[model samples]
Target: MKKSILVVEDQSSQRKIMVEALQKAGYVIFQAGDVQQAIDLINQQKPDVLVADMHLPNGDGGDVIREARQLPGAPVAVVAVSIDLAILNQNLTATYQADAYLSKPFHPRELLKIVEELVGVSH
Candidate 1:
């Protein structure tokens, strides 16, 4: 089965762009604008991986990752993205646990690479 990915980003355009790129890369894509949406989809779908922005509308992406870790499945890998790397990176050690991190303004190629790595697939 094709791997699935959940994209948790508040911005409409960014979520669409990420979904398109991941779909093209052969992933089944799911989207969430905020924590609630993300948690709802996660509970139902249980994606293979998660790509989320550090800051979100209702809550931070870290909360979602923490919750997902408790679900049944192979541990879901996560790629946490952020525009302000310094602020996001600060307190990140104690705040969140993800497989990888991507600072924003990054090329789509960079994010895709992380996805490929997480899913153990060639890109």
Candidate 2:
């Protein structure tokens, strides 16, 4: 089965970019623009991977990451993305229990690589 990914980003363009990139890489993609929507999707879909922007409209990506991690069944690998240098510099993987972290304006290939590593898939 194809691995599924949930992308939580507030900016429409940024979310689109991530969705398209992950879709092209052959993963099933789900997207949400805020924390509530992301959390809703997480409970419903239980995606294999989660790529979340640190800043969001309602709450933040950390909320979404926590929700995913708390879900039962297979564990979800979380990737936290942000433009904030301070947040990026800090160990978000430890702080948020994320599987990885990516800085904003990152190449799609970088996102793909992280997702692949988290999901144990190659493309």
Candidate 3:
């Protein structure tokens, strides 16, 4: 089965673009526009990987990453996405345990590669 991924981004256009790219790359994709929506999705189905934007409505992407780390089973591989990479912080991965970070204006291909690196296609 194709690995699943949850992409939490607030901007509609950017979220749609990234979702489309990941879908074309053969991933099972889930999308959330806000922190609550992301949390709801996670509660329903835990994806193999999480791609989260740093800024979000209701809560920040860090909330999702932190929660993902605490969930049952193997932890989710998290990729932090933000317009200001500085806000993501090097300590985020050490603290929250994210797998990767992607700056905004990043190439769609790079996002795919990062996700693939975290959760291989075979996974």
Candidate 4:
């Protein structure tokens, strides 16, 4: 089966870019502009992984992960993306339990590599 991913980002351009890149990498993709939309998709589809921006319109991505963790199967892995690495890295490993972190404006190669690694897809 094709691995699936949900991408949550408040920025439309960034979201579109990510969606295109991941889709090119062969992931079945879903998108949301905020945490609430992400949660709704998670509850409905349960994608294999989630790539979410740290700051969102309605809520933080970490909160979305917390809620997702409570659901059956949850996400196979979660990646938190943020521009403010200094702020987001603080206690993130303990607090959010995220599988990985990607800084904003990152290269598509780096992001896709992480996604492939998490979903066990051979490059």
Model 4, span 24-119: residue lDDT tens: 988899999988899999888888888888888878888888866777753458888999878476877687878888988898788898998887
Q: Which parts of model 2 are misplaced by more than 4 Å?
A: none
TM-score of each: 0.92, 0.96, 0.93, 0.92
Model 2 steric clash pairs: none
Q: Model 4 — TM-score against the truth?
A: 0.92
| Candidates ranked by lDDT | 2, 3, 1, 4
Which candidate tops lDDT? 2
User: Rank order by TM-score, top first?
Assistant: 2, 3, 4, 1
Q: Which lDDT tens digits does candidate 1 get at residues 1-123?
A: 888899999999988888888888888899999999999998999988989898999888888888788889688888888998775767664667777888887788898899998888753
Runs off by more than 4 Å, candidate 1? 91-94
Candidate 4 whole-model C-alpha lDDT, 0 to 1? 0.84
The candidate with the higher TM-score, 3 or 4, is: 3
Give the per-residue lDDT digits (tens) of candidate 3, residues 1-123.
888999999999999989999999999999999999998888788888999998998889889888877779987889989887567666776755678888889889999899888887564
State the weakest 10-residue window (summed lDDT) of model 3.
88-97
* Pairs in steric clash, model 3: none
The local distance difference test score of each candidate is 0.86, 0.90, 0.87, 0.84
Residue-level lDDT for 69 in candidate 3: 76
TM-score of 3: 0.93
Better of 1 and 3 by TM-score: 3
